[model samples]
Target: MHEKNAGQNKGERHLMMQGKLNRGPIEFKSRPAERTGAIMAISTTNVVCVPPTMSICDGVSTMTREGFRRLPITDAGSGQLRGIITVSDIVDFMGGGDRYNLVKNKHQGNFLSAINESLRSIMTEQVMTLRENDDIEDAIDLIVNKRHGGAPIIDDESGVVGMVTEHDLLKALFQGQSLLSVEDVMSGSPRVTNPDCSIAAVAQQMNKYHFRRLPVVSDDVLFGIVTATDIMKYIGSGEVFRKIQSGDVSEVTALPIRSIMTGSLQTTTPEKSINDIAREMVQKRIGAFPVTEDARLIGMITEFDLVRTLASR
Candidate 1:
């Protein structure tokens, strides 16, 4: 997610490192006019959290079922925020290894044997949470900087309050973009997959295209969809990284996507108002929603696409 924000205009004096967007040796100062007044946006008290005792698998299920990209872990009895599990953490952990031994070991053993591991195994213990009184601008900056998609908001006595997300900010900005139908802004004939496609292969495409999700299709029929977050949940909790490390490539990559896809889909229409679509996306916290008409899947509207539209406008 370290990609460019949809609305950033690299005015001048901005130098980008080759391709990897991690800021390089460039430094500078800014004037008072640079501030966009992005603070104090989110102030909701509704949030969803997972218990520490829940299995990582079940936790993954909860997030996908509820349409969340990250889940804050809390003490079941104390209701205190513990930590968080995110797609970045999952991908980072799965992507590491001292190239030689890591790759060598993975090719010879069953890397996926550890899929049922506990949540504590992969969850980040040192979490940076919002204090409710904290400025939402800071969260916005972090998101723009590609640190996280969302931040968990906390309350007095260390209880969970709510979460502020990049999508929420995008929702506010997209309402002003030139009026257009969903089809006007959406990517039609999107890349799709089937129920039997291997998760490993699908994951590669997602990483390559920086896509969050892909619609699942079979025999020219759309049934459901899979996402990067969903893949992280599967590989992280299931200890599939262990398989990747153990060199059991064949076994780990054999698992079908149907085991993880969200079968029940929420769809939009080609003629639907983009305003209504944005509101629904913000409310649901889902990045990609299929656009259908007359019961046929035709297009996809993603948060990235929305952000790009806002940028163009």
Candidate 2:
């Protein structure tokens, strides 16, 4: 088993280092890289924005199709940042359904009618906004504490500039080499397991693979994520087992992963940036994020990964 594990580790490392080594001076540039007085030199031109009066249904649809979890809402005429929308907001609206059902038959008791009416009346003004020059940490705080997934970036002139999301923070932390998409550093194949796996077995897998966390999958669908923190939290809580004696059953041995795993999960995609990932970790007070591709678990990014990447540089 030890030899097998060693072989696996070697293979994984080889796969990771397969790319060519480029020799050059690495340049590090961040949004508001160097604060220039009250006016920050924020990257704004490439921001994606939509009209404030647009239907929420349409906005949700667009985000889902584009694999974006957040988008900025802007004024159509003045192009001013109004607010932002997120996957959480849409998920809350849909009540955790796989797909939002907006249409319904008349016999369904005004389901479609209500949805239509709501869409017609709903607008982006109801959400919040942040200034472009505002510290990125401030945005992180708002998103984590307020449960917002995205915020519209605005200039001192109150015009819409760009948008920021949790994934953006992940990108910043893991892939700091360029302003490229988050997908660049995101892992395309992640290790996953079922919640029903035995604690000992799971521990063995983690030790064997050197994984900090594993995405919990059910029927090939992502349910949530379980991390080393979760395991430690469980042990620390002492709700499972207090003490063990010789010939006695350890409390942890009898526990199931689902009993202690965190149900509320925050995730990201491959298209985010490393700086964004780092910002997210600081803001959300989380140590890691499960990276996904098309809603499928692919890889994970953690504080350790960021530290290792930085050390390598």
Candidate 3:
């Protein structure tokens, strides 16, 4: 089975290295230093935000429709940091059947009323926050370690000032800014595959989509991730698969994906700080980490994504 998969993977890599997918039509060639300079110069006044009393429904509606993940929740009266509403938070609430049912039943009300019914009851406090002068590294750490998607930028008085989301992080990376969030460069609805699927099948999908990794899922639960590196390792190891020119094997056909996949995994939550996550990636020498809530996969963050964020900064 390994040998059969190896042959298929070799073909996939050849195509990829040949630029057969044409995935980089918009590629930017700028270096990281230049991108960082651009992010540092961006003014904070234009950041996206919201008030704490605002309903979760409203936050979700705005964020979902606008493709945002973090909504800065401030005290309506004082404009002070109260909490934050993130896509992961909303997903958690939705997973708790009762809240999901309630929200589904009341989707058509006025924004405020819908928020009152669906979000206000489920929103979280104890928000992780950052100050304006805080280094970008600080925010990155919070997102990576804490699994936070965004952090509300506050002042010495604790008044809500500006907001930063993963999108902002991506902007920083792509443009060379100081700090960034998960929302900054996370690709929504990324390609995924089952852990039991054949490497050949996965390789085909990766080649087709021009993806670097595929999140591994089992029974709708995120297990780990498989990347080009995994395939390359299997090939270079030689022991896993030997080159076969023409012989057909009848016995090696039913192998499960778990047999070849890396099982022990590292993960992050949307609430973690990017700095912490980046550190883990460097220390662990891993390319990507899965994002989970309640042990279920929600997303995957990769070194490429981080690189993009750094480029934007």
Candidate 4:
């Protein structure tokens, strides 16, 4: 494995035991020019995937266990790529979008029964993928232009050979150039939420704005932050199952966002360089940082932002 050969860090080591590969906190040392090779140089090979016939609960359980935000579904017999499911899809099934119909109409408000349904019901049938021969620029274009979190790398037989994500690309390009500051790349005036927002409402906002994480503010002060991972954790932690006494998902989704919001935060200043922020992200295992100035929330920076910035370099 690339990670094994590269002397993977503690976080990657932990994930390795769970069959996950090529994730970081990987240290970025190679210059952008030297690392410009096949996308496989950075992509995660031997990725953990689930069969299409897997149950929804089992699929999500694997994701939660592996700390993966997305899982590719493959054909059991041939291992050909079939579909992909993400935490966003889980959020949607939990009342964020039309997929909630399975919980309401099909399962008749029975969360247990709904979760037992086949993974195919919620998996994204039309998946965007990457060819093994595709270069890094191709991956960058596909992710940035299409707004994909990641894509599976496939071979001539259309079988998944590896996986690449924004994190992988960021690690390859963040060479401490210090060319762009956080203010230059961060999305300003980010869509935010209040502590009182319902989990369902937070999910809706995430899907609506295409944001993975949202800053929680109240009275001009940052309270906490919530992300699709938080929602997925709520379900994966077995808290949702324990809380659902009558098998009604509404009981769990009705809880305020504050109940699940991450109170402790890691934030950054506007003047910080994207290079510095990228290093911190890898070291701290953080996906995004809320930009603060004088203790006030202003903007947000994430792997996507850094990837966009570094890809240009």
Give per-residue CA lDDT, model 1, range 1-313, as digits (tens): 1123355322101111121122233222212112244334543446688877676556666775666678888888999888887654443333322221232253333444333445566677777766766664565555655545677777778888888776865665654524566776778656666778776666555555556677876655667878777666665355555445444645565678787664368888777767678777788777878887666677788776665555333
Ranking by lDDT: 4, 1, 3, 2
Model 3 regions more than 4 Å off: 1-44, 96-118, 174-313
Ranking by TM-score: 4, 1, 3, 2
Q: Write the per-residue lDDT of candidate 3 for residues 113-211, one digit (tens) a residue.
A: 333553456556787877777766665666555555567778888876666654455444433323444433445454566667665555556545555
Best lDDT goes to which candidate?
4
Q: Estimate each model's TM-score.
A: 0.56, 0.42, 0.43, 0.87
lDDT of each model, Cα atoms only?
0.60, 0.52, 0.52, 0.80
Cα RMSD for candidate 4? 11.7
lDDT of 4 by residue, 248-272 (tens): 8789888988888653788998777
The per-candidate count of clashes, in order, stands at 9, 25, 49, 0
Please identify which of the two predictions, 1 or 3, would achieve the higher TM-score against the true structure. 1
Those runs of model 2 whose alpha carbons end farther than 4 Å from true positions after fitting are 1-177, 242-247, 310-313
What is candidate 2's CA lDDT for residue 287? 63
